[model samples]
Target: MLGRTPLDAPERQQEVFAAVLGVLAEVGYARFNMDLVAGRARASKASLYQRWPSKARLITDALKANLPELPQPDEGTFAEDVRQILLAWGEPTPFDTAGIFLGLLEGSRQDADLACLREEHVDRAYTEHLRVAVDRAKARGELPERLDADFLITALISTFVLRSEEQGVIEGIVDGLLRPLIGTFRAK
Candidate 1:
């Protein structure tokens, strides 16, 4: 008979979130369970169930809670703003981001709930921030009239995802890839 542990405390909730991420990273979504999170968090499984009611809800909330505050850079120049955003995006997390991402990808394939949660919670946030920067650049006439903001944002995000493991990749991507690409789209 598991009893409910109070999760009202902010620190307690953070501890649980950390545990959830750790378990998700280690075992992936299919093998992840409330019991594992409870053991790692030192809380009763019932407490988590009481609070979240479902695995997808719990995982989504935990990921949202752990996400870094998105940076809003107004460096005037679109290129510099993007460079700042990339630097902030590459900051380290407390958990294994790669492992958690892999787990989410695996779980999302089978679980509609998890898939929706990932798209809504994880992907949307990053996309929205990038969209803002692109919109600003367009408004300032820094980008070409026909430039595809969506394509630019997606390309920037993809570059970060693919080359993030390489050392100095953020600066390299900005200076070597992004700057050159943006140059092609500058107002003549």
Candidate 2:
């Protein structure tokens, strides 16, 4: 009974994805719906369903594609690598995504589909980013050989992702938290 929105063509995938993110940034995940994305992308709802079975799946895929990659900094030190990671994610746009991320978290609690998406996509990506940098640090003798990258990353992410109503305060807060953590790692 629903009208098809033109997303069936394979070539339109990129447009569809862009539209998804735009919609997510605009209205966020809670108010977001397939129809809106389809309309924005000028694609069919059926085409979207063909590619992603649920809204969470669609958004997760788009996020993975759109989010900036966390590269292992080649600053030749663990401290610099950590600083790069914090700085890259501390940008205003990334901070804005944090709200959508929190919405995803709350939604995941009630939606099994979203929960799986967060675990498989978000968690894995976060772990892999930190793991690469930490492994490199260990190889360079900057960190203890047995240091747990996951725990360290969790601590970093907790501070990086803290909610802040005032955007201007974010840099100072992240700096205060990261300096000690980086120093601790450097001391090892």
Candidate 3:
């Protein structure tokens, strides 16, 4: 029987999560396994399995742990709030976020568990903050009464995720794209 030493320590768990991401970036979700994570983390496979029974569970937890802390700023104006959110979201991470997103996208296609986890943990993380911002805007009469919040949120998130790498992209998305789009939907 293997000891649960890695699971016992928070630092050790963080190391394991980093190892999981490293393995995921290298081999991707389809080929990711406990053995590879254990090898990278220097932990026992039994210990990892003891903590996270399924690949989906482990990967989802790892991704969640690694996600940047999103800011929830209530700037006076909706536009300013969105600008703050996008700038924070566009901040670079220590790891390859795009690679992880691609791996998750591929994994979610094949694993129902992963898909559900992605929706619950990953998607909600981004959408929930945006939802709150949108709600505040609606309350302030900044958005049209008939505006589709979900569609708008999706567009903003998709734009940030796709074009975050480019310099000044967030500013352009906010001022050039979103501001005009929101203007079109603003109460006349």
Candidate 4:
């Protein structure tokens, strides 16, 4: 959060994040060097590095910024909360997350630092985001307390892991499969 000091306002931080995401989406992670993002943001590499300790952190922050803040549920049903969480996978556009998932798993196998970030940042963000929705459901008495929301969250996201390459998942396959599992939590 402290990395984006370039602009005076929250919106300016968004501008920086957008520039970085453009580069990442266009160039992919390998070629998206700090200099390129700095050039786009019209800031120095020192500024970028000062804000984010590494390229991975920079990208992660950029991705985090681009997303709307976690959904706060007012919907009366667990089904709606679960749907919102599942629908995040289809938002904007879908990418081949399977490849990225495998790459992170394998890349972390060789690089301890990368593994640590993967474990702490990327993985945590996903789980915690899902947990927010799940927790809201529980508070509303929509989900039984016995359900392990953590495991269900993992399973929900996992539905898209292996098949993100197919591109048809966005249509409904993901939500279709996961809804049945999460639907059980709906308030009767």
Candidate 5:
């Protein structure tokens, strides 16, 4: 992406990703350009289109690469796993993800390819992490029998997202606001 064609292999992909992240950190999403990313990664413009299909997809893939995946929670308690993932999430600059996430949201409003990628990789992926957390609570007899998993997860996500611009994700803020709710989500 820096100025040439992509090299085939995981190592090359890492280099490309690193360059892209540097560009993102430097330019931010509002000013980001594929050409610039290509120049930075030294990768062919054609390779990006061939591999990702759109700027949104490419950036989304980059965002996913930069963040650690939430651990799969068969851990006997949802709170523990949820706590781990949320804490990890809290550790990162939440606003750093805004551009890619917003880009995918915009693209999902248009192209099906973009929408599918957003749904599967973004929405579903985030939801699954929360689901694993909820499932843990269910397993631990902590949640009500009729608890709505999606609603609960969405609400939790919304709390941070809604106030993010004003409040900022300063470490414990998200988890602090969320843990109270988690404590209260009992099976009816």
Candidate 6:
């Protein structure tokens, strides 16, 4: 810790977060430190600590803040809703931090705090969103009433998150996996 005052400015927070992401992408979590982030962010190590309390908290929050918002569940047919939601991954965004995402995912296996942070923030939010979509489809008689929304959400999430390099690979996998579930749906 170098300075005692916490970071109060939105611009400063963004700056620090960007630096944190860039550095994490470069050196990874084990080697990531507040001093490096502070220097890169042109803030103080104390400021980082004062704001986030720990490296894991800081890193997780930064990653969470940078993550793009997931799509809202569509009220249309289950196929259209699933396709729109899953295919959104194929479109590129400036916030594509897949490398950082993967690195943290691997690191989360060994770091309990980081794992908790991820579970609380990233995974839980996405899971809830996916659950809502599946639940909605089920309510509309578009999906089987007895299906496990959590399992479907997990499958969809894992399929996309643990994807190959080929374009549309995730889309194809998600569609293949989800369509069968759709087929199991009862008619309205």
Full-model lDDT for every candidate? 0.84, 0.70, 0.83, 0.64, 0.63, 0.73
Question: Model 5: per-residue lDDT, tens digit, 10-40?
Answer: 7777776776666655665556667887787
Report the alpha-carbon TM-score of model 3 versus the true structure.
Answer: 0.87
Sort the predicted structures by lDDT, highest score first.
1, 3, 6, 2, 4, 5
Please provide, for model 1 over 90-140, each residue's C-alpha lDDT reduced to its tens digit, 9 standing for 90 to 100: 888778766787788889998999999989998888888777888888898
Candidate with maximal TM-score: 3
Cα lDDT for residue 122, candidate 4: 73
What lDDT score goes with residue 183 in model 1? 80
User: Which wins on TM-score, candidate 5 or candidate 6?
Assistant: 6
| Model 3 poorest 10 in a row by lDDT | 1-10
Worst 10 residues of 4 by lDDT: 91-100
| Full candidate order by TM-score, most accurate first | 3, 1, 6, 2, 5, 4
TM-score of 6: 0.77
Model 2, poorest ten-residue lDDT window? Answer: 1-10
Residue pairs clashing, model 4: 3-51
lDDT of 4 by residue, 104-175 (tens): 555466657766776676777667766877777778776678878877776767766665555666445435
Two-way lDDT contest, 3 vs 5, winner: 3
**Which candidate ranks first by lDDT, i.e. highest?**
1
List the candidate 6 regions with Cα displacement exceeding 4 Å. 1-6, 87-91, 184-188
TM-score quality measure for candidate 2:
0.69
Judge candidate 3 at residue 142 and give its lDDT: 80
TM-score of the candidate numbered 5? Answer: 0.65
